[model samples]
Target: MSDQPANLREQALEEAALWFASLQDEQVSEQERQAWQKWLAESVWHREAWAKVEQIDREFHQLPTQRSFQALQSAGRSRRQFLYGLAGAAVALPFAWHQRDILQAAWTPGTLHQTAVGERRQLALADGSQLWLNTNTLITVDERAARRQLFLLHGELYLQSAPETQALRINTDYGSVDMMNTELNIRLGNNSAHLAVTTGEARVQLAQDTTPVTVAKKESLAFNQTRSVLTEGISANDEAWRKGYLVAENMRLEDFLKALGRYHSQGWLKCSDAVANLRLIGHYPIADTRKVLDTLAQSLPVKVRHITPWFTLIEDNRNISHS
Candidate 1:
């Protein structure tokens, strides 16, 4: 019985390893990529095994390119059978042992602070600043004798700078925000960063432009790699996420669900186009997503279906009936 469980684990690892190797090919088709993703999403065990295989392979790259290729070839009779063969274990073990230092350094403290999916965290900096991290956020704090800096690698953060003598700044790939005893909210999106000032003021300097634009209280700015645009009359509801609530005012259903999905750890919330434009106004708690979905079903002309733990679909009820 114990051997049966071991055999299952080995089978899963072998399959994951095959997928990992196949994906490395430059000639891999889109259909093959989709199938691989489906396999990865089907089970947690498969994901974990694939992650380990990827890590081992990455470590293999540190060796001489020609030697690494030879090693991989020798591990299996053919490239496709590389991970399943007996030599696979032999090839992977040495790289794993050699890369321990690299893996440990990657996760060193003070270099990175991250909030898990569906998790929030609050931190008090040494300079008395308050930092609140939203779901799936990663940030790094660098405090120097001359200046204090923060880099938002991804996700959102609300920062309240304490009254301090040092100059404080927050940086993203798009731009940087200079703060002086300021309270602000910044969310990093694809290719852009959204900045809203709650109190005091912030100066935003985009990557392409040298001149910093000043944003005052109740103001917001959206900047990409090339430019920054400032807007007045920032909504109070924008900061509602700090209090663990999502406040939407006649917001499109698709947009609302996308915002709500940030706080959810389970399946993605997907809405059909038939009801995507439906407007909703409400303050929903971010903590209880199941209840939020139930509320949506009650208030809107839509039916929520849980296809899987990782996929929830919202379809127009009227269309469903007609069909």
Candidate 2:
């Protein structure tokens, strides 16, 4: 999960699964075997994926089928998709949800890191710390700068700072964070910023403020260009994208979709006014946005409709929806 392109890794994993399937087809041909060998020679990632499939197969065989099934029946994932090939015998393509997006900037020259929509990246810092850049994010890090500094140009990130190292300096368009040892998430949006502290403490200062506000563990702060508000009720799952899930706990359908929308760069995700306030609760996988949508339709009284490749509409399914 070090800065490799997630999409490429996913491609390798899916292809590995298909190759495994074809090889097990009983009618497997010599050409198929040759192609598999050729594919394995292509890259280390490909071989790693192939090895993962073999290891998972061994683990599955070692466990009781019912016991294994009981342990892994979360979120109703198809057997074909097992959180990056935990089910080796599955034939359908599975996503590499653990895959991390690539990084162009190692805080070297230029020092800019960006991830495409739906892509996520993890970076190890110079000070034995780490950070994760969320979807459609861009940031700048000055690795050579003493005490270390990072700028969130846009999008979101989670940082785990080393307690023994110098305090990290995290800058945003609207504010800045200074912390010695802390685990936190920072999100930047249009005229808005959000901070959630999971461990330790962070001292944040708005651009115009002379003094910094201290945010402690389990606390969060939300602000605009100027005004800011703090809260403690933010759930730990607020940052679940790192685990490749969009968790909803008795949340409004509208709000859930909006959060889910971040994982996609498509046109839009909309619900009719009639279902806007409906409640939904679940852990939705994000590797395939369409699967998440399909899951939503199964649990909620809603219909999923495709308007265009870029647009999706969620409508009431119980009756002809007018709203």
TM-score of each: 0.66, 0.65
The prediction achieving the highest lDDT against the true structure is: 1
- lDDT scores for all predictions? 0.72, 0.70
TM value for model 1 = 0.66
Candidate 1, lDDT over the whole model? 0.72
Task: Give per-residue lDDT, candidate 2, residue 115.
Answer: 76
Q: Give the alpha carbon lDDT tens digit for every residue of 251-320 in model 1.
A: 9998888788777665346676678899998899888888999999999999887643334667687644
Error of 1 at 188 (Å): 0.6
RMSDs, each prediction?
A: 14.4, 16.2
The deviation in Å at residue 243 for candidate 2 is 1.0
